[model samples]
Target: MTDGNPDSDGLVVAAFGNRGRLETAEGETLPYLLKGRRLKAVCGDRVQWKQPPQSHEALITDILSRENALQRFDPKGRVEIIAANLTQLMVVLAPTPEPDLFLADRFLCAATLMDCNPVVVCNKTDLQHNDALRAALDEYRQLGYVVVQTCAEPGGNVADLTSLLTGHTSMLVGQSGVGKSSLINALVGDAAAAVGALSDASAEGKHTTSATIMHRLADGTRLIDSPGVREFVPNISASSEVQLGFPEIVALADRCRFANCQHLREPDCAVKQATADGDLSPRRYASYKRMKNITASGSV
Candidate 1:
């Protein structure tokens, strides 16, 4: 775990509780434990650490500054940071478990707020296709979001996804039963096995099941696999900033009669006018309204 050096820098790979694995600057992987209770680390964190004397594990001492963090509201309505320094967010969806466009919208909104590129991945392409889901994906594409269709089964088509993930720190997120795990297994053949080994070694197999694990692709791409959730609410600090999540809305907001129009019951609202004129997606506008109200109320 040590190169005879007192301290070294490492990247967090799999974080569960205070114990996880970190990859050293020299590409060596070592188990790590947080130095203090207050020090919270997540996948993709660049940290300073050192091997404790008489111990085999590294002790994470300090977390380096982050470029940005992806966060969401937990069940208790508290902000929970999911990952750090993410360059791309892959929102995976499937035909099963019923596609939640609202939830997808929230993830995309969160990605936008974090300044990360968001890609919508439609998994399980071999399953019976839902026209409604197809239309929804089309709407996202029309709005300038990249939508990639993939099947995560053996020999499934994931080439496009691989291309998108190259040279980026990407995280996969979506509802349960969306085949996120399958995609991970397909993308990195040994990812599932490595996760199991790490969890077992740390005696955190059960807890790690829901933990975010980072995997490295052969091309130097880093992928963080997050547990699927039933619902996701982005931690929007203010209602005024909600419009920033919706690109189409932001583009038209400048034309609203009121400079600070919320686009709700505001006369001559360019967003409302666009919705009425069929220039903007009504469903998307409705989603924006829902998120706006949620943000204003500071709850789900």
Candidate 2:
């Protein structure tokens, strides 16, 4: 499988463990196996593959360069890449299972750092909007993130959601109970993603998206559905990178007394002053501080 001659340029459409499905330039979809442990592939990755004379699967020989990748640290403090070559990061959240604002902040930060558009979609609008959810969405909107309230199951205002997804490689990411799969099913006009119901006791939606896979809309837009997670922290190399992830912080950073203000315990810190003056959401500032601490510690 690792030998020469049978070569093709392909795009990774699905990723599961060590193997993935690659679509060739000629439009042939084939199962591809990795050439070695060093070559890891994810959805939207451009790759080169070769097939041995009598091999059943194509061997992924090389992974092409990526424009950008969404990444975070695993529990063991190892780097975990969510996806590659994404133009949008769709952070889905809802009223139930308790929307984690901090988690949403992390995803938005990652998007800003990656130079990708971050969208906040509040699904399950059939459920009454809790105060916390409303506050979170309002804050995000105030911060200039597009926030849409959608009812994926009953197909309410789905057209508005669809309009934003067109012409971009968008990824649906959030905790398990946020109706991401439901939104996918509604958008793609099919039951491609498995939708799970909330448990009676736990009030949490079971994880249905088991793998990271890419699907295309009729208009040629690409969408990736990622597995639900309880906690997420973006992978940042340095403390300076943390402020770059927050738009408000970056906007006010120049007004700080020190050029290298970490925004924590520094004199005349505009960010801290903004939080104190109610110009910045305290919750987001707290999120920034916590993330700064995580990056400063050099561990999760």
Clashes per candidate (backbone, < 3 Å): 0, 0
Q: In order, what lDDT does every prediction score?
A: 0.88, 0.83
TM-score each candidate: 0.92, 0.90
Task: Estimate candidate 1's alpha-carbon lDDT, on a 0 to 1 scale.
Answer: 0.88
- Best by TM-score, which number? 1
Give the number of the best model, judged by lDDT.
1
**What is the C-alpha lDDT profile of model 2 across 190-280, one tens digit per residue?**
5353233211224354346677777778877988887788888788878789888788999999999999998999999999999999999
CA error at residue 148 for candidate 2, angstroms:
1.7
Could you give candidate 1's per-residue lDDT for residues 68-96 as a string of tens digits? 99987777878888889999999999999
Superposed by TM-score, candidate 1 places the C-alpha of residue 244 at a distance from the truth, in angstroms, of: 1.3
Candidate 2 C-alpha RMSD relative to the actual structure: 3.3
